[model samples]
Target: MPICTATLALGSVSGSLLFSNTDIASSNLHSSSVSSLLSPVSNFSKHSQRYCCSSRRTPWVCSANKVTSNTEINGQTSPVLQDSSVPPTEAVRQARRSADWEAARSYRDSGFICEGRIEGFNGGGLLVRFHSLVGFLPFPQLSPSHFCKEPTKSLQEIAKGLTGSLISVKVIQAHEESRKLIFSEKEAEWSKFSGKIKVGDILEARVGSVEDYGAFVHLRFPDGLYHLTGLVHVSEVSWDLVQDVRDVLTEGDEVKVKIISIHREKSRITLSIRQLEEDPLLETLEKVIPQDGSVGSDSESISDASNIEPLPGLETILEELLQEDGIIDVRICRQGFEKRVVSQDLQLWLSNAPPINQNFTLLARAGRQVQEIQLTTSLDQEGIKKALQRVLERVP
Candidate 1:
């Protein structure tokens, strides 16, 4: 059975009577239409909310699918066996709920975008007024199209202004049993803008929101409207290890990002911030060490180090490598050592090195700023020459 509520609350009708003369005369309810008094029902939620502020009417009749407390001057409000006035069986509830969800699912499966008003907001996200059932627009599901209106304003302020305004959204989820109906404005925008660009294309974007895993950036199309939002994973945020994304990205920061990947079906975009610059991990090592992992003869080999004077100790070798242009510090260490070298220089402590056949590390700054390069080998009484016999020969 369909869920319908058609109530006729007769203010002037006589008690225990369908219609009476004395009451109708005093309240002036005689002018009310009699035909609506028999009609079953129409819409429910939107009309049920209309509460009569003042008194004056022929008859309060709600001809909607649901019973409304307030109705216009039509005997339609009569308690004519409406759905709410009587308890419904499980089959009835399931039937109506299923009908509502079927319509919701149609919107989702068809990719039908529609205008919905923001009824209110809560901690989780915006509450959209969608007929009798309120659909939820989760904060994560909101797109740049929705937030770009006031890019710099706090979320609360923007939601306040959106309370009654309509926004274009599509149904992303509609599950009848769990009572979940979700909407996404972002997904709707993606269908419109995803075709305009492709992978490897560079675009200017604003950081809309930052989370522990990554930052969501709103891509600014050439037309100036933010049409799509993409994710910038924390690992792609920089060449340096990022412990916290907030340390580098904040909401509303303008940045240029490269599209590393795109998934059209999922409407996802992977972006990178570090790929814009050259990787300098090997800049400081190329001149000093055999890249092929071989010890070459003094002439055919380390040509860059041929002019170097033989060093007496590890500290001496440090002085020589530091002579390279823009080389700030040199460190040689075995792996699994202190990760920090840019902030503090412990190079002067090289005098504490143990002598002979011990696996040691030699670090050199070859114009790569303060980045550490690890070179592992044995060190003997002959000093650091044992570690760098290929690049710096023993002094006779």
Candidate 2:
């Protein structure tokens, strides 16, 4: 039996072969024929030795010491050999797996994580982690009640607790590779709000700041400090001319307001404070005395003789009118008249009196010099007297 290690090319086998030491001399084959048959094997051994030992390398090689043998089948001789070598396939697979694992570890090591604490806050937003990675928590994101007209003292008090507390966060965004980190305590709070709060909820808030244009407020809510500030536009603050907002509302005032809108993605909360109070203008107009100066018989208009032209003694009339009405420190300007009235009401009176059109100017002496006022509207005599009386009463 011949032990066969075959290199198959399609359906046929070829290559060198080896055999054990067994020999039989055949009567039909001459010695020369045997020598000729072995000659090819000898030459094959020399070629194989040169191929294996040569500096020009290949993937496989055969050692020379092994004896070569030959067998005949179908008039063709096949060479057999003892030793051959080729690289194993398993080494390549192991290398690829190692490379993949290393890449994954490298990615994990390079990822970013942030940690800080909340600090101070303002009407516009919260100021946190000052002097060490300060972050802003906008009013809406701070809490679900962030949209209240005014944030409560409790919310602010909770914000106070945020200071110096360690907060773990991630670097969700970066700007031009800068060290600046945009953080949100409110972002974390939003999930809780979505679960708890619904549309059309009423909340209490505190006035944070009042501007000529509007007012800012903070709202109290769970999850974080939230604000529900909005504009109490000069028009909305009062129907009367609002020369300044500070005159109406100041910081830290408590107010009840309603939520008009909540934009969770944009993190905005709209609130209204004026809705809580009665319209001041309507109240004033309803209470105002008419120009004719008749108030249910108790109030009466001045006599017609009071309107007539008079003698030099009329100066006394003017003096009596001033004394009885108690008008003082009168100043007139192009638009109207300004005067201090000495009365219980202590009101400041401004009016455009007779012979005054939009272009008409007036001059009046309060104490020393005459001041000028251009009239903006025609005045009603009864209304003027009544207004003067009101002012005089109000003056200290």
Candidate 3:
């Protein structure tokens, strides 16, 4: 029989190995063909700094037949190893995993796209065979193409149809200490089109899904297909207050959104639907308040003389606050808050929430620079907690 003549080297000795493709299963070690394993090993060795057998099961090492410790090849003899000199199984596994982590880190740093096959999935996400070690592809990291309009389709139902499918993904995170590898298909898609788009660019989008916090929208590319996804936060859903995000947008809703911000490194896009339209609050009160950088016209200025308005209610409160040190602007956003018993006040603050009645996020200016901005409320901290709880309850 003709012997298989694929190559392997030990130190200075370089010669053809006796083992072949069929040798692992066969009683005879050198009788089978070795050509099948040659290509993969050759490709791997070209890039790796160190050479060793494949980091997989390594069945050949455990095979019944063993090569003699003393073998001469091309007039160069390799050093003979004693029985105790072999590396431990756990040590070899750790080394292999360490190398894989480093390789994954490099891929993340370089934004390289990798193809992995879905082996299976669990509640957490899809498990992919990323080269040698298994990697995780979280549901949130999935591309919009994987989602369908069917509301009945659960996460498991969506992922169930994707098993054995090959997917292009990027290594979003690789932590050696935690031994975690997080992959993202959306990031892979982002790398392709992020350069073509930018912040403030209006784009057509189709809503992928709706949650209380925001709606996920897929940005349509020039080719008329959704390529990237961005989140339209609830506050950005409309010019008016958004009680619930689902009230404004839903799955498959076709809309045009303005890109408010783009995070290229993190592969995130912040979109705004309200920005496409004028802010109703600002528009309704435009004559009352001046635009950002321009001073108000004398005729429309709120502070302009108005025969003294012949009115002076609670002028003492304003007079006392304005008299305080470094208190330049004392504009009141809202007034005439309804008074109620402490119990009723607590209930309404919890139910209607965010303590909208209270003054929040106002800064006092000193000279030309602004000073401390405070977030205080008429109700205590528990009211804030209840308000947040109510908000989170509406999130999908």
Candidate 4:
């Protein structure tokens, strides 16, 4: 009897082949002909090499329909049989895990971007299942569009409407040992503008909110329509002292700021309101304070002002200068334990006022000089009286 050779395409395994007919020549089945039978398994593994399938010991049965051609597997020609009852082998499961882990790493390093459907909320963030893995997207890592501002609503309650929403995300952290995967929709969103923003760039911004430490500004760039949030630290708010951010800034206030720093790793943009304006104190000092070749030619006199005693009757000279001009320029000569000595056009104003730690310049007469001028409340009459009394007492 002339024998017929048949090939079976199994439901699960990729490379396994079942050949039954003994009389037919193997040469007759060309590898090209069996490509159709391998379609199911090839399609399953296109995303990642990791795949799982049944590893049952039961023999796979071939139906009356037979595969007429040969198939390729791992560079060699091979083939499958359908086994309905078998489960995947332990070896297969491990291989699948290994492949999945490798895929996760690729996604992390290469920034494999993907979109996930929001399944639920974990009270602090959204839970999303993506690519056969479940990852947590923390609230802080969520895009501003999805963030809830309503204080009365719970995160889950506020996110209830987002249960079916699809969000674009990137895998940030992935660990197979702990089965932990972290995703950030915010990062994915910011990638669009990463190339556009740069340090020293000026942005027209609106105050988003004021915090104790700083204020967040919604930065507007001319090239992009999206608004990025940049932080303006309290110290960067203005040239003048700021006791409270709320005092200097309020929500929705439109202002211009300069980008001082960009932290790409953290996705943080640091802004400065002060940078947008020239520093008044420094600018004034540069203009009035004589440099090396100027009127104050003696560089040694400008040397460390620490050891130099207040010129004999220096306080008297300062009071005289203050009286003449109504306001004398005080150059910070040096600060000591309990006193600070300042110079006005080469003259000294040594006062027992508690030493001033900050670099400051003020236009003021003797009446405004205080022993310890409070930066925030320098206009206080009583504080100036105390300082003037101390200076006058030193003269006589």
Q: What C-alpha lDDT, on a 0 to 100 scale, does residue 218 get in candidate 1?
A: 85
lDDT by residue (211-313, candidate 3, tens digit) is 9889989988887667789999887787545677888887888899999998887778999998788643333233223334233332222333222221122
Candidate 1 local Cα displacement, residue 281, angstroms: 3.9
Candidate 2 lDDT, 165-277, residue by residue in tens:
55433323222122223444444444344344444566666776677777776665553445233434544454333457788878777767666667776655666655566
Error of 1 at 278 (Å): 2.2
Every candidate's lDDT: 0.54, 0.38, 0.54, 0.51
In candidate 4, position 142 carries an lDDT of: 66
TM-score of 4: 0.49
**What's the distance in Å from true for residue 370, model 4?**
12
Q: Which ten residues in a row are the worst by lDDT in model 3? A: 344-353
Best of the candidates, TM-score: 1
In candidate 3 the C-alpha lDDT for residue 1 amounts to 12
Candidate 4, residues 124-208, lDDT tens digits: the string is 5666655434456776666544332343455567677677667777778776765566777767766766668899898787787
Q: Write the per-residue lDDT of candidate 1 for residues 154-267, one digit (tens) a residue.
A: 777877778777777788877665556678888777776788889899998899779998998888889888888889998778755465899999888999999999999888
Residue 134 of model 3, lDDT score: 61
TM-score of model 1 (CA atoms): 0.51
